[model samples]
Target: MTLSSMSETGTCTDIINLRYQDGSVGSPSKPQKFNYQDFGQLKQTYLRKGRLFVDSTFPPDYKSLGNLSDLPRSVRSRVEWLRPSDILKAQNVKGEPSFFVESASRFDFAQGKVGNCWFLAAIASLTFQKDLMVQVVPTEQDFEDYAGIFHFRFWRFGKWVDVVIDDYLPTFQRELLSVSAKTRNEFWVPLLEKAYAKVCGSYSDMNAGLPSEAFKDFSGGVHMTYKLKEVHDRNHDEVLWGQLTRATKCKSMICSGTAQKGDTIVNTVADSGIVDAHAYSITAVAEVHDGSSNVRLVRVMNPWGEKEWNGKWSDESSWWNRVSSEDKAKCVKRDDGEFWMELEDFCQHFQILTICCENPNFIDGDVITQWKVMIYDGEWVAGRTAGGSLSNSTFSTNPQFRITVTEIDTEEKEDKNVLLSLMQIPSQRYRNDERLRPIGITVFETPAGRIENSFFRRNSPMKRIQLYGYERDLIEQHSLKPGEYVVVPSIMKAYAPGKFVLSVYTKTETSIEPHHEGEDDDDDEDHLILPTPPKPVVPAEKSSVYDIFKSYADQNGELSAWQLRKLLNETIAKGSSDLFDWSACRTMISVVDADRMGRMTFKEFSTLWSKFEDFKKIFNRSNVSKTGTLTYDELKSAVQAADIELDDNMVWLQYSLLQGDSSISLVDFLTLMLRMDNMAKKFKDKSSDGFITMDWNEFAADFMFI
Candidate 1:
């Protein structure tokens, strides 16, 4: 799909287009149903039944543990699944065993046996933003009314899905086995982890990941990551420090991870007391006045609840004596896994820094700039839209979006105005079942018209945004000129089907539309061209159509798409030497496949075949020049003659898609009509009150086969 945009003068507008291939724009709306499970009804049922809720969706069996062979024999044998109530009893709680000891904070939990420090680090950062934390871990949840069920919401793709799970957590030797709290009775840590694990497919699925992945899931916000080593090497410490200060002021979630030294294993403590390959949250950034000068300091917290940094500005270091009493009071020294380190030492030890926020105002420290965001939900169907990278001939088939940047940002010296983010949505329910494809986006400067295969073949891309690795998300900032540009996102290989969410954040007002084929450039009434009346089919031709249908009809007097294909190839299509393939036949059946049984009765087949004959007559009559193709205006007439009512935009979209050079071939025109009819019928059948709702799998099943 391709999108085209135009500039409009007004306050910043945020548009969210969801769940449709048509390039319609609108604001975001709530999904009528939640993914996986519904929380409210489930909880109420359990409460009314007077029984604890045991999630059959994610049971306490070994399946939920995911591959027990990866676990140590002793730990695997001793592992026991226990609910919060049972665990509290084992701990001998005096009073009520609360879900949380107090308001959730960074110090509330410690890392467990799972190698998900990346996730824990994001959680640790999440603790600082109360609003986001509440969104992820709803505060109303508690053990008092708990029905042995807990629910947490995480941003999945473009929506927030409530993930519900039983409170049953994996334990060993009567001790909490996952993310334990600092206080003995608090259970939020493990419960939250369990819910996330369920979302990832199983506990093992959450074993290792990037903090940015968890950060995006936690807040569904803009993510920005910096390589500390690169920043230090470029002598951009001040630039990075500025970003950190602004990020902290913006209340963005921040996290960093230490580099793994040569031949060193993860979590291994080095001489400086920093753990390798471990994630840590940046709690604070300060410029403390040390008697002689001001020292840039960063507060880092290890999720382990220990292993404090022993370098300069550490709790035990003599560097603290140089700071003023007021500064020292502000920066407390403790052995509780958190320590302040000099900015230089911090950069030297940490390899990556990630910050996430709902808005990206923190970048460039431009607090007043309100960016307009446009989000689109799209998919790459294997044979249809998944047209791989630039190297492939089918590259033009990839989804294309048009962005028209009407104005430039004068506030910034640089022309950088747009931020493009392409995130692939997982088709599977679990992490282990899905593989991240190497995806990238290509932006092309084109003429003010529909982009086609010829355009791509003739022109090189203006810019190619390549993600360094096969990552789930790719983000890039660009300084595009004020004009119409088409953005194409694709996997490195063709025919790899997947869904994706594309977000465009721009400083200036811009219109974004999916540059679908057959869409018309003009909708003006004066410029509209209606198709000529079709030449009447001879009585003999009409009689022969019925004769062919009767021959293909089975004992039940019904013909499947396959049978219809044979009938057409042997009859009307035989004269023109044009043969319909299985795909075209399937589409033809879907046009009248009311029962969706892939078969059509005589009545349905007669109606479809008559329309086909009428369309063929109109196709020939419209081709007055006898060029063996129909111009855009001629195609519109043929469509109308066949009683396919399409608005100017829809007509243009279809015309653009099938047109070669400046016109559509007879084969392409017929295929377009079949597709339009099939799509229209499917839409009417599936839509309810003008809306169609489907999960990823449902959408794939309904649309992919045809």
Candidate 2:
């Protein structure tokens, strides 16, 4: 499968084109289906059956309310589930209820009891851009053909998924409990909110989040965040202003949040009329001449549809007197929750500013500059591909994507040509239950070939973005010379299962593809060759080890592992420092136990004795330091010397599993070799067409023994 596709316009057109059957791209082996509930099919079926549709997937119940502990006692006690028709009718004296009163606007909705102003702020900002608005809330549906079902599309990871929800909404005292519309007959706000809540697993899961997080789910675009505290510097303020102005001109979605006061409760209203720890949308940004100088002003909207900023340049402020009639008229003041604030006060009050757009040219301050975007979906499967961080020996086993930068932007001195975004996909049915894994990305300048563990051992990463916390996404911008590079995404903890999407945005043309070991080369030539087994050590002519083995054997002439261990320590390992342990001796017996018995007969003992002698000589030779333990490389060489076949990845994995303190003892090495032999033999006997399928019991039995 292709790793990514490029687009010059920086739009989602390339992604749209890449989409296959259901607007999904990437590996077809396991494509993600959109809106598992088929709206059209369900609508027709329900209509034919003379019934209204009800979504069983996201039902109207306490489960949909999420964790009961998060709900207030008052809300939980009075909560009543109601459909839109019931909600509108209970309010009394309303015309036929409609999904939307008219064209949706920022004033259409007001935040309810949920502490999700961040989400409401993004929804308010979305209203300003109708094109983006329609992408999320399709304009095709209405009350005219109501089936009690509504679907909304959201950009999830790298694909758009349609989330369907029934019209049932939670209400308290006959009023919608979440987001409610200003017009009583309009039900779009609450319905849309329900759909989004379903995507988040439940309404409670939507509590307390960054606007940028919702903004990404809304547009799946390039998101840039600015820390307002950092903008206190004059130079940084100017840069931020330039970017915000350009972003506004480009019609990008923007939102900001107020910093929390010391131990202050969230949404606590201050005397200044601005809520503490609340989110707001930037509806507009302008610079007006106040007869003296240009005054930079920003229009901010509170999702509550009330409680607006009452400081200077506010709706009732006398600051409008200084500006000309034209500018004053353009900046109309009202009590609709939207008011103007001076740029200085805006920076002083807000802690974070976020902007998102399909095209990120606004970040460069040059809207004409277009970028090429590429996206890829990948997963980290435990044991096989979840190879943890760079410090891990199996890091190379993680998925790797190779990208070649063919050109660079020459307009700037040090252009950040590449932008990497790694987003982890949630694996739980409920967001509250999902524990996000700490994920990161590493980039390395390398030759145009598949990288292996050896390469990672010999080289260091050119760039690393380490997020040790449980962040859903990690993004970084890098400036590098034109060359081939490999990007590796991994979880901080080894062998943790998860999925992710990696998006690459470059200023110029680039090519990317997933790299697999030996995919581009001859497998036979790259395979490691095993050396000839060393000759067995001879016993003293008169003594003869066979005669000694009979003494340790029982009446049946069979030697158990305990007996074999005694024999070895007394003879072969008598003067040698290295000695066989009970576990190693047991594994050795298991390896050659053809009768499935725990003991070895004389014939079996003879065969194992010769191999054991050869292995001991090879191990001693490979352990040049005579440390009584072998490093990863030394152990690998010893295994090869004993004529055990294994590829580089397998050898690395085995060593990682068996090594302690970066090395393995002779006993551990012997056990490892024996287990590998048993596993290989089992696969050869059980596998069909190179794939083995075993039930849980069989798998558990084999795993325990192996």
Candidate 3:
């Protein structure tokens, strides 16, 4: 059969406007550009359950540092806290949570599965000073807890801050979430105040999620301040940083932390500093996870800064062992915070903070010795760990997520072996709702950048931000930190295969850490990268060469030589990347046959051109560098010293010769190729089988002078 008997894609209007054959201008259907920010304002007419899901692995316990050989397995196994270093390491790799952080000092004790606020509080205090994280204990050996703490005094608007603690978190009687978490979520009173020193704004304002709010709208806000991020060697680039605080006087920003089951250290840095999206403090010596007894350990903060080791003690391993000999407990591996990777999977799994504190300001007497943990509130990008299955908001009706928790048995000798205690088995789609969920992996790439958030449900808002467009329906406010970004639809769709106007908006600001009260302002501005350049405007690509020919054929109700040449030349000059791209263009053509059966329409030219504009743009006169058209010599000459001999015109001719009735586009292009293959040869060798493929009107096509 001829090429006209294939499937139908979209309907065509005229030479300028093309829509789906069904009359509606088709939208750019797949390879979507999702507006996570104003999703609420978007037209909710979704092809329900049509998207795939995303998932990843969490940090592993076996990869944790330190040993717990002396402690019981139950306590060691059940005890777990989120580490700042690990979170920062993960962010560095996957580059997720792209929201830029303030250069201010910050801290937060991550409540693991057990929700031990007490332990998180103790760790929070340790973040105040490098030694505090070290002095605090994680083991039950000498004074009970073996975890240390660090502190760094934060100055926001003004006034000194104080927050101290060493206790366990309260648990829910019936449940520990949502309504169950109202008390813990509430600000001040018994829970927030008793443990905290003095909340930032006042005892009444801890709920504002300071540093966050302060940075959002305070005198020395996050926008102008400067920070020093030297977690690595090359920490000196002026362009990377955001501007310094426009406000003259700097205020202190501090977080409060409760205590842990057993931790030491009186004071540390007053408040840990922020780096990228993380906060950190120094620890005296650390005892990570070990299958045996609770190992004495030091805690460290991720100020988005470096792991600092001053070498106070001569023998590195004398005071505390970086690596434990007795403890065989499973340790949580440090890796990228945003993406998931198996803990035991080589170097990608775990990472230790490298010490790099050389600033004279970071002296023994200057370090903030006491700190409290704080949690900022805003548009949070939420994700879950690897799941065998996934359900909706609840897990009772249909357990969509089936996770396996490995209980570290430190009491027994067998637990010390690097064996997985419990592994969650991957569950096939069973529940009806589970199948509709965005559960597997859905990577959204737009003009702004890339958003790789994993959605649990079909319509769950994994990405929440300000609203836009369409009156009340449009979510207008955007919660973007300086250096953060967003995607917006630019133009109204006309020839657009789809109906949407999206544009990318990147914040034109930097992220710099604030300065100490007594410290001088003379310092190098590093870490904060300048805002990305504004996006360039791109024109919508017209139809392809073949599609144009097809359109002319259908309009005139017959195929003519002139129509064929025009289509062929158009395809070569505009649609394809040179005449040769006709083969590639044909490959594009081969996909859409246009009819009900296996046939193609003259309009495939338009369809193909619109789809592959970026690729086609490479062949334009602009890239060719010639004034109006590509000259014959320019075509034959090396397109650069790269690739092979030129065949721009031949490619154009071969595309016209392609018979819609029989054979493939490739075969047809090859036939023309075989006809003039030898044209490019320096001196035709009689014995050579290749034919010369040069243009007959070389002189006429040279100057582009019509």
Off by over 4 Å in 3: 1-37, 42-296, 300-535, 538-706
Give the per-residue lDDT digits (tens) of candidate 1, residues 608-638. Answer: 8766776688899888778878888887777
What ordering of candidates by TM-score runs from best to worst?
Answer: 2, 1, 3
**Candidate 3 lDDT tens digits, 445-514:** 1212122223223333213432222210011112222222212121111111111111111111211111
| lDDT scores in order | 0.74, 0.74, 0.23
Looking at model 3, report the run of 10 residues with the lowest lDDT sum.
241-250
Candidate 2, 1-706: lDDT as tens digits: 0111111122222222122343332222222224345566777787788777887757888778776455678778778889888887888846777877778888999998887899999998888677778878978888777778887777877766666778899988898888988888888878888988887778888888889988888878778888887885555867877777777766588999998878844678989899999999988777887777888888889999999888988988888888877667755567788988888898888888998877666777655445666677677755567778988887877888887887776778767778888898765445566678889888999996678889998988876444455777787777767899988888997666677888877764666566545555665222211111112243565246668776676423467777789887888668756678787787777677543345676667777766666666777889988887798889878878866678889889988987878887766765676677677778887899988998654464455434
| Model 2 residue 473 lDDT score | 70
lDDT of 1: 0.74
**lDDT of candidate 2?**
0.74
After superposition, the stretches of candidate 1 with alpha carbons farther than 4 Å from their true spots are: 1-35, 68-70, 262-265, 464-468, 520-706
